[model samples]
Target: MEEQLFEATRAGSKRNDAGPSRGGGEMQSTTGATSLKLLLDTNAFIALEPTSTAVERGLEFGAELARLAAEGGHRLYLHEATRRDFARDHDLARRSAHLALAAKYPALSGIPKSALADLLTRLDLPAPPLSESNDAVDLEMLAAVGAAAVDYLVTDDARLRGRARRTGLAENVLPLAEAVQLLRDLSPRPLKPPPAVEHVLSYQLDPHDPIFDSLRDDYPGFDAWFAGVRRAHRPAWIIRHDDGRYAGVMLVKEETDTPYGLPGRLLKVSTLKVTDEAHGRRYGELLLKTLFNHAEHHSHDAIYVTVFERHATLVDLLTAFGFRDHGRSPVGELVLAKGRRPSVQDAALDPLKFHTTFGPPAIDTRAPFFVVPVEPRWHDVLFPDYPGQLSLLTGEHPYGNALRKAYLCNAPTRRVAPGSTLLFYRSRERSAVTVAGVVEDVHVSHLPEEVARYVGRRTVYTLEDITRLCRSARPVLTLLFRQDRLLEPAWSRGELKTAGVLNGHPQSITEVCNEEGRHWLQERLNEQR
Candidate 1:
């Protein structure tokens, strides 16, 4: 939870409270202070265009953010680069309107040329020749954050956020929604919940259902495909709008009864669609995630989809999740596929020659086992099917590329190789060892770009979240592990301590080296039989 920045007084006011020290990329906020400043990205300014359609809900939200911040006594500004980006538009009238949007908020004269040049050389960074060039504008925007010109730089672009984090300005960066939330939380006005009509619900619909016929325009061959759909094929995952209309749908086909012919354990996305109203709301991403969870329950060799080239946004989203371009279909649709390589557990967790010797040495020659701590929230996101009332992680619950993945932040204690056992110690609220898995692959990087590339489209955390988590110099560890199974009855932390399997609560990774610890865990696994 974020530390409260002030104390409410009886006189309908607040006073500055002694809160945690803010440094090293920590969010800074104060009570009754006008120090908080926010800079909007070029796209955010464009989103505020007057002629935008209601379906561009993100644009409306972006405008609302500015109004809220202004009301909350916070200044909304933009880097001078924003003006240049807006001016780049060929449409003179549109460009003028965009510039007008920028005029609403004061512009920060971008980082001084001398300072930018010197810093570029000092940091061994490239300085584009033309100051008004796109690259130069990007650098200027980044320099605004690096020089602490703004308390928070708000943007809808994830790559820009990642870039800011790479340049050691993570805390200064905030996504549009997050920035709005922070401003609202610190606002004097009481926070009001969004209308119930905005909430979308997920439900399953039969493959051959008539409701799906409405989407035939998006999926030209959907009717023919539906006719060939297996009787036992998995039902389509649907998201319904608050008005009870369909917002999005994902039709998946798995198993030997394949759609695209390439047999043996395949998951094909025959159709994925989201209505205009839900375009920027991430409903489509949720449908894709639903497919991932379904694939986890079965052995699928690959997950593939045929999307039209015109669907650029959908294609970009797919590419973010590690989907590769596999030429085109016979009918000329773009084909993308994400192959699921077998994990160590899938091969029965072979101890000998488990992995080539690139990673950390095995704890024991027998098999590596460590009690890894997991935030209860993450535990539920990673193991959603686990028994209990699992709370949704977010509106777009389980964000990122969550296909058989786990994140290790703040410098995990140990770096185990593939085939090593990870006994999940679900900490805080639910203190227990409830799930176990084998590490399939590990990617370590201090560079957010490298980490993002490694994770591809299978991360559960946004780039902003990853930056927040890995604010320190400590490298981020991205573990690609398939959860083998969950313990029927979870082993409480105290129980493990009494059995000498765990000493105290392991703040970092704690190896289960003792023979007694292995025996105890083995007995729990035996219960499954």
Candidate 2:
């Protein structure tokens, strides 16, 4: 009876009647159905592109996905926005390629223009003068997903990911790496349930604010209680995001606060949030993954929560993801339990790993090609030893000789002059003709995550900005995007470790040209020719 009392009274303290944080523990999903409807972000689409050196991994990724769909019953969601983006970008590429041909005849240039116009209209490009809303682009994506009622928005983009978390846009925004691994957790592999980043917000906030004030009633002394819980469990961790200073955090605990004599293994979750001014991102889900780890580490018998009985939306999630209602408290508050019923308890938990790890993902990001002035910030950092950022350097890569292109795009990350260096990473497929590059460049298409970081946000160029910088910035070494592939087809299984790009044992080499970065980029110029 005493235990039941512990579970009973706190039903009201739950997040929106989230049964007061279940006391005792949280359970691993050793037997849960796939209650999530996953929607891939732009990065995922790029990963699926055919030209990526990581193309071989795509086959395995798909196979893993199919396995998950068969067993867990998860519905993969794709937004019209994503499809539209692809269409528009594809149209741009086709038009640009055709225009290049038209340029040879001069007279046909007008024809390509006409074709381009038709392509643009066919893509239904959202007319510019876009919404002034901070996350207008993100909102477009969200509305696209919302219409389909997806359970999660999986992405790695810092800005867009945050927007989803702030507005409660989707069920969760997960990293591409984790998203693939989740698929691997199904049959054929031991179900190793690792800590998951579902609905994680990678920053923190003051609980005293107005929004929190309204939520304070749930935990009369939430701040105090949280401090104590952290001191008790000590599972605090830091998260990293792109172009941001603050790392996201999570405040979760295995609490003793049970509700209404229910099965008491409830893990209390709090402040699964990102700090204010967080570029709306996927931090919410990033933080939740941390708690998932804590619950598993503590070996809690079950997880329970107190939340509003009417949060139909949240309720749908909780129910789908593996939480069950242990019957509401006598006061009419809802009580939820994990590992209670015979339903979804994460079958993956029974195994040692719940997610699969691949070599760093590859991306063929596209942006309008152009010459841009490399900022002093980039030069000073990358080439302090160089006499002049104007010096030209080049290399021949055998890896780029076969299967794809025949030249090395760029060499090691080094400093270059302001107007001297031109950098850009383009998608090989369609959309995003290319992502303009500046000082530092991230070759996600060929490099791993860690190495990519060393190159992350190093560039501060947009298609328009590139033009301004080109006029005066000194010419630095050119970093182009070329193709590299495996000599043998079998090497293509699973994830290609990110390091392979940095150190691969290939057999040939090619010296490439930087014509694409030449003066005056005609939009839609192709890199191949």
Candidate 3:
């Protein structure tokens, strides 16, 4: 069995290596030749080896990593300690065969025993007994990572990850799925954006797909309920990968009477599920964006969802967007609801709080407003819905898909308060204000890594882009905002100057502090509605 597996993997490697380059290297060359060094743990190494049984058993991320390495010119190495651990296997022939297989990759030198022991002590880990070679090897790998020997240490060990978190090395450790996503984010290739959300009848779906399995387990009569929905031809919203696999699904229905004593017409989120593979990619938030946009467009009074407490991530996301806990449902599920009404009381809330509470199309008119100048290149990606663009290249960018987005600039304007109105003025060819958003937060930083962590998945800018911006030694101002409206009949440069909204062609983020200009702009927005 060992020899057969080895031969099978060798054959698979040959097949993989024979494919044409996938433009990763070419893309990198255009962008200053950035590449990552990935250090794989023993389990990650085996799972990623071509044709390995582990890859067949749902370790598909490993295959993705291999492809990325071959195409992107990334270097993948195995820690020398992994080799020693493999040699200790009880099955002599299996051990020998695996050792030979491991020899295919370059080896990362192991840390010295004394240094490893000191590092373990510093991290508050007990030294492993002499007999426990595996534990010692794990310590060595983590020590190397802590010392910044590699860009990342890829592993799936829960305990090891826990230790990493405790020792402040969590950012350097990654599970296979997240590791794959990081590489994808850092890759220079132009990726296809995730598919747009589609509205379809319930009957059009396959209820037995793995995407629905968890929903079935959570609700006893889920299948029967779905069958009824199918018969009624209930409408649903879904997102799928290019290969036709479901990334997310949302089932919603309109309720005329208050189902839970909530006022006005309500849209109940009956089911919202994002596949495990899509968890960290923010597809749930994308689906929520779709749902919120639908409700606002259709003028629904409120939205609600009943989810169990065990789904904490989903619950947290809901609450973050101003969903309030309205107590428990009949089945003991937590009922979260958000109202569409913007009350006088909402005027006092901060920018972030106001937007979260009332959602889009419900901005605080009392807040200050600013006209932010954005270049044409960035305007297209940051606000893809702006009209007249020949083509919008989203590149599977999460920031483009998200209603909540970040913009980075080094303009003189600073201290834009949260809840402040942002008029995104597309400079150059378009030269008009095309989009509007509400500020959620503001951050100023000079370090690229700090800025990266601050904006996170919210910004369309890549690390390289941020690095370039920081090269000028000016502080990068990261503005986090939720897109509120796409202005139709966008206010042009000439019109803005005539209305006193701008004194001249704006080159930076400019405040619209003139009361007459603010009033005129407000009237225009109301007229557009």
Best by lDDT: 3
TM-score quality measure for candidate 1: 0.56
Off by over 4 Å in 1: 1-39, 49-58, 67-76, 84-101, 112-234, 255-263, 273-289, 308-325, 332-334, 341-385, 391-422, 426-431, 436-486, 489-500, 503-509, 513-529
Give all TM-scores, in the order shown: 0.56, 0.26, 0.71
**Which of candidates 1 and 2 reaches a greater lDDT?**
1
lDDT-sorted candidate list, best first = 3, 1, 2
By TM-score, rank the candidates, best first.
Answer: 3, 1, 2
Q: Per-residue lDDT for 1-529 in model 2, tens only?
A: 0000000000000011112211112112234321334566555544433333455434444444545644545455444444444444446764444334323210100122333233234335454224443333355555443333443456667666544544444234554544554443222342121122223222333333443443456556766765565455544444443333333555555567655454546565443334432322223333433344356456555566656654443354345335667777554756766652222443323211111010001112122222222223333222221223211121111111111110112223233311111222111121011112121121112211111111111121211122222233221122322111111111111111131211221111111123432322322122211
Best by TM-score: 3
Give the C-alpha miss distance for residue 19 in model 2, angstroms: 45
Local distance difference test, each candidate: 0.57, 0.33, 0.70
lDDT for predicted candidate 1 compared with the true structure = 0.57
Clashing pairs in 3: 193-396, 351-419
- Which is the winner by lDDT between candidate 1 and candidate 3? 3
